[model samples]
Target: MKKFPLLALAFCLATPAFAQSTQTTADLANTVKYRHAYQSMTKLPDWVAKATAVSVPAETLKLDGKSYLVGHLCKPHDCGDHQLDIVFSEDGKAVWGLLSRRYGKTLYQMPLGEPNTETLAALTASYHKNNPDDLAK
Candidate 1:
């Protein structure tokens, strides 16, 4: 029964870590922290709204030495031209974004306001991972 107790302790310790990492985009959207951050925007973009409406898988990634929940969201039917990569701090207290749009042969990426250089770089890297062919020239 000593082994059983140790097994129970391990299971309890692992549950939160597993749940935190496995949260999907839909799960984060419903969070109060996420809602507050998103709603606080002064001029919300239309594509951002549309993209979040669709559910996509999310992953926990390390960005700038901190854990962040990252997800790729895109406009339905026009995903090739418009896409958004969102990053939320592990605590869900902070948020950052990268918006990418393709026009003709050129692709443009605009980071939300001025995320730190490391964050912007990580976001861009994450975006490219999602779209290997969509390189930012």
Candidate 2:
């Protein structure tokens, strides 16, 4: 009886994450290559790097004839609640990005704008429901 309740409790606690995985998977893809991914991640904007709470290593992704690497950001380091998505040039030479979970729409990489689907999916999976405006576009 005791073992049964413990097993049930663990599954119940983990249910929400499983429920949300499908939604997140629909959002996107990226895998960071080991070599130089760390170097590339270091090129993020001053505000972004300083603000990052949890940092995932950079992943190399090819898009639109450009070689790009993406870094994930969660929670601001200042102990405030905020999120960001950052992308870097493979050589650590420059940064390219317009990620979801950010403060504003403007970016240094693509000055004009891009399709919302491409931009928003760059963020964490939870962004989908929270940022309806991003999905609508």
Candidate 3:
């Protein structure tokens, strides 16, 4: 009887931990898939819209154990001869700005602005310079 109670207690304790681990694994996998999908899209407008649509998976938990999703969007330029890059992230509940730029050996970051025709034009210009074939749209 004592052994039975002890076994029950152990099982109870292990169950939540196992569930949490499984949840984390699933969340990480989803994050990776979103990252890849964001990378594969060639158009800026589509990329922004897609990034904005990302939501935190149900399995994610904040540091406080509260569940939340964060989304981030960024545009970056390399200072001098370096390359420029734009990045975005979404966790489900909210989006974040993860912009960065390099300026003469220094790095700068700013939030992504709302997508608009003008912004798309600028992105097209930059993309054309970086990847001519991307203009196939």
Best by TM-score: 1
Residues 2-117, candidate 2: write the lDDT tens digits: 99999999999999878754433323323344335555654555556475356567677676677767665555453123445565666877654444334355322221133245
Please give the range of 10 consecutive residues that has the lowest summed lDDT in model 1: 47-56
Candidate 1 — which residues are off by over 4 angstroms? 1-44, 50-55, 135-137
Encode model 1's per-residue lDDT on 23-104: one tens digit a residue. Answer: 8876776698787765565455676865543436888888657798888888777887888888888997888899888898
Best-fitting candidate, scored by lDDT = 1
After aligning candidate 2 to the native by TM-score, how far in Å is the CA of 77 from where it should be?
7.9
Tens digits of per-residue lDDT, candidate 3, 15-56, equal 977774445644654586565664565334433445443222
Compared with the true structure, model 1 gives a TM-score of: 0.60
**What's the C-alpha lDDT at position 45 in model 3?**
46
What is the Cα-based lDDT of residue 94 in candidate 2?
A: 63
Model 3's alpha-carbon lDDT is 0.41
lDDT at 34 for candidate 3? 62
